[model samples]
Target: MRPVPDRRLWLLVLGFSVWGSALGFVYVLHSVGCAFAWPANAIRLGLGLVLFVHLALVGLLWRSYAGTYPGAPAVDPTDSFLNWVILWTLIAAFVTIVFTLGPTLLLTTCT
Candidate 1:
């Protein structure tokens, strides 16, 4: 029988999965809005809100991980992997937020 993963590992995986799913959802929302000729301001506002929520969720995840596992040891492979995954996920989400906001800020109307 295969051993189940640790709770922390499961939490980390679920957190990142949700983060990635949110990113994709935002993209879909923007695309659908554009396709349907929604007002630029409306679409931008909605996307911005979604992005803000995503950032908040990711921040909470980071805080929770830190609180639960204070001063994780460097020698533990799972801890190190989880830390790296969380870091990269945050970076990716930040970059996505910037990309999504850029067009909204630069263009007043959908082209």
Candidate 2:
């Protein structure tokens, strides 16, 4: 019989996927807004909301993966390649967040 996949692995995959999608959605929203010449403030506000939600989701995922807080599950095994993938995924998501939000902070107009 095949052994069941680790719960931690599932968590890692789910977290990465959600975070990645959130990042993509933020950019897509911005592009759509710009395409129709929506107000700059409106686009910024919408993107800001998306960033906030993404950060929240990332926080939850970090807590689940690291398990540093009381009552949290133990950290996943370090030996597994999946664990490394999770770590890289988290890093990539954060980088994406910075790239996605930096323009809003520095620029006031879509052009």
Candidate 3:
């Protein structure tokens, strides 16, 4: 059985990391915009643009390495589990960003 390496494990969390970064960045953007009294349209546009960037990031991560790591060989239980976890994390991160952050677009900002 091929044992999963410790160092490579970090790849599993990459999806969540990107999502978290996006969340923090967007929060900062909103706070700054509100503090500066940015017009409603500008704030909304900024948020939308940031969200688009995050979504694109998550998409790239998923596309590049969701499952089946590079140079991986025959099936092994540990490798299989790791691959599944990585895939789900990416999926969950994508769904979460959409569901949680999407509503902000519809509602009034800085309310």
Counting clashing residue pairs in each candidate, in order, gives: 0, 0, 0
Arrange candidates by TM-score, descending: 3, 2, 1
Backbone steric clashes in candidate 3, count: 0
Residue 96 accuracy (lDDT) in model 1? 64
lDDT, model 2, position 86: 68
Q: How far is candidate 1 from the true structure (C-alpha RMSD, Å)?
A: 4.5
Better of 2 and 3 by TM-score: 3
Judged by lDDT against the true structure, how good is candidate 2? 0.66
RMSD of candidate 2 to true structure, Å: 4.7
lDDT of 1 by residue, 28-60 (tens): 887899899999888878877776787677677
The deviation in Å at residue 97 for candidate 2 is 2.2
* Cand. 1 Cα-lDDT: 0.65
- Once model 1 is optimally superposed onto the true structure by TM-score, how far is the C-alpha of residue 82 displaced, in angstroms? 5.4
Clashing pairs in 1: none
Q: Model 1: number of clashes?
A: 0
Lowest summed lDDT across 10 adjacent residues in model 3 is found at 64-73
